[model samples]
Target: MTAALFGHDGPWTEEEYLALGETRQRVELFDGSLHVTPAPTPRHQRIARRLGNVLEPAAEAAGLELLEAVNVRLRPDRIPIPDVVITGPIDLDQVNIDAADVRLICEIVSPGNAATDRVLKMHYYAEARIPWYLLVEQETGSLHLYREKNGHHVEESTAAPGGLLELTEPVHVAIRPERLLD
Candidate 1:
């Protein structure tokens, strides 16, 4: 499904979206809706990159890998490009991702995505049974961590700019929230 809606007639698939490269906006498909996102501000990129720097090496040491802004296949036909994802046996090495292969999914919230990140995406990720999901809010400089439980997402913890987000499995990494604001 490479058909994506740009304005009136879209909902393009990944291939179609890529074909129209260099657009000022980035779009992702979630629950069949075309989510058009604004270009990342420098602040957003900085935070995303900083988080990657902190987590990537640790994931590798644990026999896992990290992917940035990669499309994850949550179902046979549903894909949501998350800001950061960590999993074992990296497949993007081949240039495409099999979403079911994802272990953890993270998103750094933008102004347009506060509701989606905190609510809609939360349900979707929970249903997919992703072991862990992190939501980083740039405006608040906080991180919200959720872990799947009995087919639902249970809020595991929340950390502020100077606070620590501790995890027990996959890599045992603790994040410094300020890293997400950089």
Candidate 2:
């Protein structure tokens, strides 16, 4: 991920990060350091919105909630804001959702932050034992679904634009990659 490190000499604690409060930019805490990113581009936001819309109905039917850009506290030292998340019902006043409540986490690949999404974040989700991880490669219009198996994530399926992405766990649903881009 292309992150602009803060001028601080050392990593910030979780309490310190929370004290910063909400800001215009998106900030994630990883490895005790803060990884800050600018607001998403219009295209990125559009894709995220569309994907959320496509998933909401199915999620609701399965008693899951679809939320966007919410902080997920994976560990005491790690809090990553996924682009889209499917989880059990969360209270409106909740500051951050615990990893245990998360059913699925999705990251829409940003050109500059591809590695963070595909590598670092993927590992973090696996380590947290999150059930499902979805990776949407924006440029390629592809979707990848990873399932947690034996404490690690393994690719269970992949679909290209106009292809169907089917999921059986965390709620059964089918999505088309093109719908997310459109």
Candidate 3:
């Protein structure tokens, strides 16, 4: 179910991928291959921003850093830019933040790249041992929170527009799915 957007002819090294700087589109590395996705739509950006607004104060109260669209180096060959990440303090100058510093990673599912957000990225985040993963469905205005257990992800909870999306691990926060959609 994975698409080979780049490195179709052969595998690519991490250094080679990094050299292609400031792309207009989003690029990710998986298993020594490159996956490029188009820029997110305005709606997607709005949702991500709203979710960040809700999370920022909670994260700050818990003494965690809230970041958006930052590169996470899960491994030398695997670097994925998560839409939202809550983690410990990080050095801004670092090329890519180590996955070990990450506590929770959230992705706003894009209409065109839903599979990459729901499937591929889920597998990669679980493999990285990130404690919590949040999947925000752009079309349905729902949120699915998964927790890592035994090196895999288990659906911890889910909420629709009226329901509250609450989390205790990584940080304590409560948000409504409807707010994320607006």
Candidate 4:
């Protein structure tokens, strides 16, 4: 069998996981298991980019940086790649951001990622104590925003279609669900 096909099988240590480096697919390690997903589709990528653009200025103004393609380490064996993350300053060579440094995490829900993004990731981020969470359901044109309170995530705001979702905590920024993919 080709190494690429079965190389990542079985349990993975942090070093081996990180050594996979930059692959076309998204690879994550959690609970000593490796989870791999195909690259984001064009539509998915567009939504991520547009959303990143919307949050860039606000993040910078808040003394944070909006980033993607960076791993957020929640535990020694728990690491996942968020679609978007607003974090404190980072060294350019760093491959991971400590959960404590992450201010906000955004995940865009697509047909393939709905369950993971909405349920698993939500639970994990809250467990990591990430202060804010934004869930964008693309097909429905809706946005679900949450904030961490008492170490748990609480729904803070939501919007549908052209509706406006305004957030003031962690940073001040307003987002319209429809504009995220435009």
Candidate 5:
């Protein structure tokens, strides 16, 4: 695996970093290191869109906000672009306006990213103390909903075509398993 690169430490501000322009691939900064991710595949986009379709209506009804493929600052100089992110309704300034303020994060695993999402990203999200993390695996048509329990991650529920997923408390966003594959 190629090592991620961190920008040289200096007086560079967040606005300066965010304003930097690039016309190539998507890049992320984790601990001041640059991590370049491969372009998402068509199947990846399909799964992400399907998830949004189900959640958007429910979120709207609950007065929540839906952000898609947006860079969420998880820590200072560290940002990870979740496939689907949901937070409480708020003005732009009150939301994830910088490198923090993300409540729930989701990632749709593509071919090469399956292992990394399962291991690296999984641990990253857990360590970040995100209340809820959702993982959708296209190959198995599986949806794994993880809730933070006892300061660790517990697979609260798994749903496939025949199963029904319950969001439980808090966000209370639920959708049928098959809808995720649509």
Candidate 6:
């Protein structure tokens, strides 16, 4: 009955993917496949929270909002719940938002899925033409900022340990990477 409803013979459509309701893990729809990722660790939550705190003021000043773990539909067939995102005012009742509304998307690297964040998602976000992508590596307590140019992402800045992550685009904010962890 379930398979019949979703049509297993063809690629999952946007309607079918959105109808997934809720699941145990983070699920993203890309092309004809579903990308499932395990739940984040408590530490991952902490970093996102800390980043939001520091970024909120600047984001608000620029008339953008900092949101965590919200679904962003990059296209009719691509939607991924980015860990953190900065966007213009949104309808609170919306289930998800268009990627065009997103000013910056952040992904915290899961310990075992570093490549997914560093390589795979980077490609997706870049391909989606998102202006900025921020990656936080928990193991090294480092932050890497990439700016999309042409059709790919280029490293714009990096902050690690005693260094500071500073940026003027998307929003103007600066903070030490160590503060994000502790």
On TM-score, the stronger of 4 and 6 is 4
TM-scores of the candidates are 0.84, 0.94, 0.93, 0.94, 0.80, 0.92
Look at candidate 5 and give me any clashing residue pairs: 5-33, 5-34, 6-33, 73-99, 73-100
Runs of candidate 3 with Cα error greater than 4 angstroms are 1-9
Error of 4 at 174 (Å): 0.8
Misplaced by over 4 Å in model 4 are 1-5
- Model 3's TM-score against the true structure: 0.93
lDDT of 4 by residue, 1-182 (tens): 12754865667888888877788888888888877898998999899999999899998898988998679998898999999999888775788889999999999887977899888888889999999999989889899999988767899889998789987867788988888865
User: After superposing candidate 1, which stretches have Cα over 4 Å from the reference?
Assistant: 1-24, 93-96
lDDT of each: 0.76, 0.91, 0.88, 0.87, 0.71, 0.87
lDDT of 6 by residue, 1-182 (tens): 34543456678788877788777678788886777777889999889999899899999999998899888988888888889999988886687888888889999898888888899889989988999999998989999999999879999999998999898998999979999886
Worst 10 residues of 6 by lDDT: 1-10
Task: Arrange candidates by TM-score, descending.
Answer: 2, 4, 3, 6, 1, 5
Q: If both were scored by TM-score, which would come out higher, candidate 2 or candidate 3?
A: 2
Task: State the lDDT at 115 in candidate 4.
Answer: 93
User: Which regions in candidate 2 have their CA more than 4 angstroms from the true location?
Assistant: 1-7
User: What is the TM-score of candidate 6?
Assistant: 0.92
RMSD of 1: 3.2
Model 3 C-alpha lDDT per residue in residues 29-50, reported as the tens digit of each score: 8877778787888898888899
The TM-score of predicted model 5 comes to: 0.80
